[model samples]
Target: MVSSMEFLRVANWVMNQVLVKSCYGVARKIKSHSFDWGDLSYKPLQQPSSFPDIVKCDLEGRGSQTLACDFHKVLLRTRSFFPYFMLVAFEGGSIFRAFLLLCSCPILWILNYEMKLRLMIFISFCGLKVKEMENTSRAVLPKFYLENLNLEAYEVVASVGSRVFFTTMPRVMVEGFLKEYLNADAVIATELHTSGCYFTGFLSKSGLLVKHSALMDYFGDTKPDLGIGNTSLQDQLFISLCKEAYVVMNEGKVMPRNKYPKSLVFHDGRLAFLPTPSATLCMFMWLPIGLVMAIYRIFLGVFLCCKFTMALGAWCGLKLNFKDNNQKKSESDKGVLYVCTHRTLLDPIFLSSGLGRPLTAVTYSLSKVSEFIAPIRTIRLTRDRKEDGETMKRLLGEGDLVVFPEGTTCREPYLLRFSSLFAELADEIVPVAVNVHPSMFYGTTASGLKVLDPFFFFMNPSPKYDIEILEKVPRELTCAGGRSSHEVANHIQKQLGYALGFECTNLTRRDKYMMLAGNEGVVQENKGRRF
Candidate 1:
């Protein structure tokens, strides 16, 4: 008698050969039976051209012919017993290979039985449902209860109070049911669920009800049950076993993918979510211009310092020392809407680089325009859109928004009348003062003598610069009727002058004209001798 190990080895070899032969036969039959454009004489079947006519083929009385064909297929698939015999004979025989073959019998039998059982159950249930629907005399119930049917790895979709239970339905069907029957606007699901279902909702006539989902932490929830279908029971069992094996394999492993996203409470008294990909890309694209500006500033800065150093080499140069008198030791965690005195063209860049992290600077839409060829890093406002309370509500909710209340640059370190844009963000204000010593050769005037004001190169390069950041101050003014933005602007101007060691002056005539024009004035102020 052959041993169980020997029997198993033979059975495995037979099964592999049979399966390969069957597949090849199916493929060849499909190919040979296919219709071509040239085969106009022969009538084509009503069914799809690629389908195999296996059931239609006559398997009658020529038993020898059928047997010969089977043997030929097996020979083609396995290349005959000679190769197998030669391999076993030439090599040392291993008992383990034979043991593994013997061990596979119970697994294969279980798989075969499960597949047959699932198919039988599916056919039986569907038939029963069809027959019940056909019956005319039977009282129709509002809801149908389908029980004893283990639909594992399969899905069903229907309305909550629906009579029909759509079997093995997908996102397309679910979306249609929700829009047509349920008459609802939004259907909630997970990220995966939305991606899968949103297209279905969009393509439908009812228009896409936005696909939405929320991610919740799974605590002790029951494992999700996917109803079974074409997915093999053995495959499912294997997956479960593999999952447990992975847990055991990774017994003590701990891996952290990345750090948390950074956040900042801005200087202009707004909370800012740190740079997103859109913002980061905007910042990155601005690097080229930023680099050019930085290099120009450095060269201009060194030249100015050298000139100052030489001039002061003989006389003790004004004893230049900086003291942040506004700095408070007890005032930690104070939020400020930094009302800055805009003077030199480099004021924004100077403040951004000088201030510590978590200080958000308010910039204009024009600042965003400079980033257009790159990415827009700053908060953008249209004077038109600034009045949008809804947009402002959303913007303020995000973080502190900085506003250059003056809205234009000035020659002296003085503030212009403030815009009410600041009043929308917060009540807290931190007055920042930025001063550029001995100003620049701003540009040529109409008569061609170089004017010393900073506005000429508004978007151009600044020769050199110095910026001063002060402590947080409170917002004393409210946006009440009759209270103007100018009143608040003057308040910040005086505070800035005292901090930056400069004389605070009212708006120059050119400043007034530019503000009226609603354009950033790029004009040069007349050069005057400095004491």
Candidate 2:
């Protein structure tokens, strides 16, 4: 029996050697026939006639002509592509994958552009689900793209009647943003290979799409009216196919918030800042300390008094600025409903601390974890008008109650339409304008787990919140004074908007969820808890 086993092992080893040699021979023959290392070398091409700056180009009659531009080079102000891929790795894949990609930065630094891009694609997309990638592209990427957009390039692109974008990045990454936000007529980008709804992290059989070849194929025999790109040789070669070409020398000016083509009211993501290689490394290094600090803050809030927590937290880099209007409380027994702009889950907690007393908070949706760790009492509102109204009235009867009339958190400097329910319940209303600044991560997300919202907010090295208590509404302005509920709600919204320097819109919580998460912003109830 032992001799037979030895013979079997010998036979298996011989067969494996033969198979390896056969595969190597096939690969060598294919490489010799179709691939050349020299083809990857960058050769200098003659510069085109001094191309005009896109900003100075005349826009008259340009709307009727076709235009082509490089998405990364011309549209975005920043030249680095690391932050975007880092987003994909962190949002679509896991943090571990993102760290691995970060670790490969040294290797990427020594490689050529093509090699760097290919490596990034593999590390970011390999084994990620197609649906998750699509979700992140739809919900998370648009905000970053809009924030980094170049104002001059946007003006040129918007003026053109028809537009085409060429990018070396994966089509899935840029296609949605370009088409939906920029109104791009078409996108030409590298396609990724997928197997059974999972990305293989490899390019399609056609490999990286050649921008020049793609431009020619897209418009055969007819030259596009305008081409915009950077000063790279490949970009020069691409624009040469057009009737007119312009080079974009990025001067590092980002499009201002007011100049955005569309209002970025609803975006879902954990990252608050652009994750460049260096910034990402700093974040990883801070995580250990950030986690400990976050837990300590939570513990202090839960076990200690509000004043003590605030004092201790300030030492740990928490900034809380409170502005009190000193509005006198009404002589009536009813509690004052403190209506606040919802910036995060911690708004009520911070407000309670600012007021130097405990207050009941009513929320439309809150995670179980949030409720468990909350230092003050919290009440969840049912969407039913009558039921939620009754719940708020009861909470107000006990003491001063805090309510976010927007029904959801808005990260941008904009306020969603206030729900009228809060206006009807309270006789005396005080509008509180709230704002938060976190350096690393956003405190709210529409598509991610709500339980982690507070932790992420606390994870920042330094987080700041400004709470301004506005003058209380006069008796004649509230619903008790014969005004309609909606009128009171609108009045409160305008006051908060004016205080925070935010724009007031009729958009509701439903509008936000539909755009960001493809839902109606309804949290599923679990064992009597909704989030």
Candidate 3:
């Protein structure tokens, strides 16, 4: 009989051999199946034309032409698909699932493309809710996709009359973005098997959509006018059916914000950076230390004075830049109202810390957890114009008050339309500009639990906030000086926008929630508290 240790070693070796052989077997099976390209036979070009050839072809002149392209190769800057799978796992499933997917990176690297894709799909989609996956694909994935878009590729696609994209990814993951954002006429991709409303973590019976076969079926014997793809044999074979074919080289270039086909005003996700495998590993490694540091920082802010907290926070990787442009105020019993542009839930807390004085904050909604952990006084505002106006007036009469007139946090460099009520509340209104930078995680989410916003913000390795208190609005611009409330609000919005180098838009909280969360931005009242 073998010894226990010897038996264990033998078992491990056997398992390793089985996994390697199984993966190779799958790879062989995939290669053995050859796709029939129908009767539309065209000799493969010995050397396919590059992207510039198509650019030189002047695509705009071909008004009747249609384009067929590979989604990842032609559109994205990066070829690796790991980051997208990690996003599905983290946002659609759970963090543990994401970590498990990260741990399998070594195995993924060794396996062939087909096997690797199968493994990643299983890990990311298994046991995930269909609704949750749809939500992430709708809200979280578009931002990353837009960020990775290739400028040269987009120029060609946008010039064409009709566009069809093919991909190996599940249709549920990429369909929404491609159709809604890129205006693709159709997206042919793999379909996932579903058990009721949950993903079964396996492909449908039809299996992965073969790009060549799908393209043939889509356009029938009539060949496409233009085809764009990468250097892979599969892509090369698929595009050969077209009258004109162009191969995009994997040169690292991204589309600039100014050149974006559409503006990205609102996106919903907790991650600020792309979660590639190595980046995911680094984030997990820092999490233990990050949590401890976050608790310490919170304790300091709650117990100590703002001046002391600021001094100590700098030593622990927290940066606060404060600038005051307020003119000396006459000694009066009435308090001044500060209208600020919202960046994160912590904007009020940081402003109070910067001023080294306590101030009342008015918000549309606050979670019970956030209200309990807050360092300064907070008051909730009901949407009723009469009631909210009275609340702000009372708060201003008591002491200095801070109000975020945009009513919600916006991550992009655009300020939402300001509410005119604040302009009517006080004669002396000061506009404040607030901006935050977090290296790893975002502090706001349109769909996730609101209670975790501040915690996630503090979890960053280095978080920075810039607070600029601008000079008070001239008396002539005030509502009390014969100006309409709307005029005063618009004036303040423009002032903050100019100071922060941001654009002002008429987008409201309702528009943001509808786009991201698929709901109106209303909090249900629970036990006499609104969250």
Best candidate according to TM-score: 2
> Tens-digit lDDT track for model 3 on 321-366?
9999997683458798989999998898899999899999999878
The lDDT values for all models are 0.31, 0.83, 0.81
Tens digit of per-residue lDDT, candidate 1, span 1-531: 999646544653453344323443443344355311121111112222221222222323322220100110110122111222111111112223223322333343344432322222222122122222111001111001011111110011111121111111122223333333323233321111223212111122322222110101121132211111112232223223211110011111121112101111001100011211222223233334434433333333233333333222112111122234456433323344556776533454444434422333444423222333211124544556455444555555554434576655544334555565565555555666655443112321211112222223321212334455566554345344334556655656676777666555544424543322222433323421110
Residue 329: error of model 3 in Å? 1.9
- Model 1, stretches more than 4 Å misplaced? 1-335, 358-360, 365-369, 372-376, 385-396, 438-440, 443-464, 475-487, 501-531
- CA shift at 117, candidate 1, in angstroms? 99
The candidate scoring highest on lDDT is: 2
| Candidate closer to the true structure by lDDT (higher is better), 1 or 3 | 3
- Colliding pairs, model 3: none
Q: Per-residue lDDT for 18 in model 2?
A: 46
Q: Give the TM-score of candidate 2.
A: 0.89
At residue 266, what lDDT does model 3 achieve?
Answer: 95
The residue-by-residue lDDT of candidate 2 on 38-119, one tens digit each, is 2112222535546777777777788799998999867987567788998999987888989999888878767787787889
